[model samples]
Target: MESEAGEREPVIIAFCCHYCAFTAADLAGTMRQQYPTNIRIVRLPCTGKVYVNMLLEAFVDGADGVMVAGCEEGSCHFLEGNYRAKKRVNYAKQKIEEVGINPEKLEMYHIGASEGPLFARKAREFTERIRKLMQEENEPENQIQNEK
Candidate 1:
């Protein structure tokens, strides 16, 4: 997972809503909760703005993982934006899987505006998941190299 800095740092691009997830992430920073530095957040007016192509592009452009973080269920500022984002995330996951990438590399999270600790925890958890995924993807090759 750590293949010389910037080679494979397990990066996750998080698309977060301004009212919910983005605010929660800001609170996480304010609270000084330590999470992985690999997360790159892109604040959006709503998670509904997240398109499947944007997600796929992230992977194509080198992101190891992608996350669409939005308001909790029944609490979206835009009424149904979070739900839309969730569906898009799932669809994007399927698309990536079809392209031979693990669907687990993409995730959707529901976080409230005040859930700072949860934001940090999710960030850490996603980073770990990507690390394990990368490790698993490399294991067979590593084994073959050792046998050689």
Candidate 2:
């Protein structure tokens, strides 16, 4: 579902590796597949290049959820870039949660060329999760914080 103007749409930013996940996303688009429209895919040369601050910036800029998609384990075009990304994501997840957002808001997935369908499915599933999170847990705390 598309986010409306007044209602905060679950904004999801997907950081995808150029070699695998990004290409698969493009293929999903080419195949005329319909996935959640809320996800915005950003292509990175490797997941390793994504910094912790970059993920935080997405939330600061209105992203309700963030996802990093890279090549399957031991299948990176850049050898171990995805491994580095996994570590960074874990750190960022903790940091984000400490700052009052749910750590589940951030996720990581690895897929090969043949997993475009899975990529699409993941996007859908993440979007749903974000939607539910937003509905159930987003308001009370923010409302209290805003009153202060």
lDDT of 2 at 29: 82
Provide TM-scores for the models: 0.91, 0.89
Q: For candidate 2, lDDT tens digit of each residue in 1-148?
A: 4456565778799999999999888888888778988999999999989899999999999999999999999999999999999999999999998988899999999977667788898999999999988877648987677467
Among the numbered candidates, top lDDT falls to 1
Global Cα RMSD, each model: 3.4, 2.5
Q: What is the lDDT of residue 137 in candidate 1?
A: 76
| Full-model lDDT for every candidate | 0.93, 0.90
Please provide, for model 1 over 1-148, each residue's C-alpha lDDT reduced to its tens digit, 9 standing for 90 to 100: 4666554788889999999999999999999999888999999999989999999999999999998899999999999999999999999999999987899999999999999999999999998999988888779786586466
